[model samples]
Target: MGPKIKQINRRLNELATEWNSFDLGPSRRETHSFVNSSDVIGRDKDKENIIDHLKEPSEDGNIPVIPIVGIGGLGKTTLVQLVYNDDRITELFPLKLWICVSEDFDLPRLLKLMILSVNKEENCDGLTVESLQTCLRSLLNDKKFLLVLDDVWNENRARWIELRDLLRSMDGLSQRRSL
Candidate 1:
């Protein structure tokens, strides 16, 4: 039989009031449908390589910064995503972050996304980009993280570099997983 549990020890029933509340959004299960792809077309060798990389976070005495570069519609995103979600990878790096820099790249939006992805239990509402940057710095300052920036396309590479800098400044055994 299961072990018996303990009891509560509260005296007064103090009720708390909500202030500037945010809606308890739907779970990922309900919001975004998981695209089943176990039977998805092949990439066995690539998957193996990613697993190996995760095993050895360093290459040539440096933390490997792998950039899966290729032109559009070449399955770059798909390949990266597959590796990102692979069971072996999921086991290796406990912390993972994925941000999509689509055709239209925006700083505030990207910051909000990074905050939400890492600090799932916290709210990012009303936080300015600068504030977000500060908070991101604090959150990632000493945490080993894997950040993925996907689908980048812009005439000016400056925008991409700006975001990359912020990511690079993050702490912990962090590495950027781009495609």
Candidate 2:
């Protein structure tokens, strides 16, 4: 009986260690839009293609959604960074906003990030969706803006439709650029 109790205790300790190992702690890592163009290799053609598409006026007059799809660590973000930093992009779109969506697709949070990008001094805490929408609309009221939603993991179509509808509702958002 004593030997059996000791074995059980040993297994419990092992299980405890396994559980501890599984905890990865809080994620502090985040992606930003800054990139070193010289260090980037072999993505020039892809970048140029995206730029060309961006330069072309939308025939249907709707927001263009350009998706750079690839598995993790395949330089999708890097390629986007290159495009974002291009001089042509700056000339084409007067306003550019980069938001790292990263798994959580909370609409208000996204709005807050956009507001922050435009106006760094804004206090977006505790703002309602309507307020955020009004604020965003005011900022982008009559401007051609480029918004990049990077590292998005949300696949829920309904949420996307809601966001799309919100953007479409805004006047002059017709000339918006999104990715």
Candidate 3:
């Protein structure tokens, strides 16, 4: 690995160790909450640019992948959440899916998540990767979809290519697809 990658891995390991050692009250339970749109401050320009990009049509008629790259805690997730929840964006893309891809980038897991996100009632147990991909394709057929893979840390080119190829197969069914 390169020095930068090694540094990142080391820092991540350190953080994991620190997190594991942190103490919470015995009765405490972690609660997850989203930042309300009203409470999000100082990201109007970033939201606008992303929204504008989403509104623009690709000349090649292919799906566009817009990446929001930044270091941790820089509000990249918040910005995308704002854009994802925007009225115009919702209207433009009828189907929206958000998958949190933090550190674990297993293709089968991702496919299952996508299927579940499309329809919460889906039974994805024991399904192979090909079957999962087929189910996802069916759910996305004839729809304009926005898929947000948040906190993606996988950098394997081969794995990415495999996932991209699977997603690319859905292009014919999707009017617009975002990642």
Q: Pick the candidate with the highest TM-score.
A: 2
lDDT-based ranking, best first?
2, 3, 1
What is every candidate's alpha-carbon RMSD to the true fold? Answer: 17.6, 3.1, 8.4
Residue 106 in model 1: lDDT? 78
- Cα deviation in Å at residue 40, candidate 3? 1.2
Candidate 1 local Cα displacement, residue 57, angstroms: 3.2
Report the lDDT tens digits of candidate 2 across residue range 1-179.
Answer: 99999999999999999988989654433688899999999999999999988877766756778998989999998999999999999888889999998878889988999999988988888889999988888877888888898988889999888788877777775578787
Candidate 1 lDDT score at position 144: 60
> After best superposition, candidate 1 residue 117: deviation in angstroms?
0.7
Clashing residue pairs in candidate 2 are: none
Error of 1 at 70 (Å): 3.2
TM-scores, in order shown? 0.66, 0.87, 0.79
Q: What is the lDDT of residue 44 in candidate 3?
A: 99
**Model 1 Cα lDDT, one tens digit per residue, 1-179:** 22322222121222112321444543221111123457558777886776676666443433356677777677666777777777776666566778776656778887988887789875778988789999888877766666676665555778767876776666543343333
TM-score of 2: 0.87
| Candidate 1 regions with alpha-carbon error over 4 angstroms | 1-35, 58-64, 173-179
lDDT of each residue in 96-165, candidate 3, tens digit only: 9888777777899989988998999999999999899999989887678888888788899899889877
What order do you get sorting by TM-score, best first? 2, 3, 1
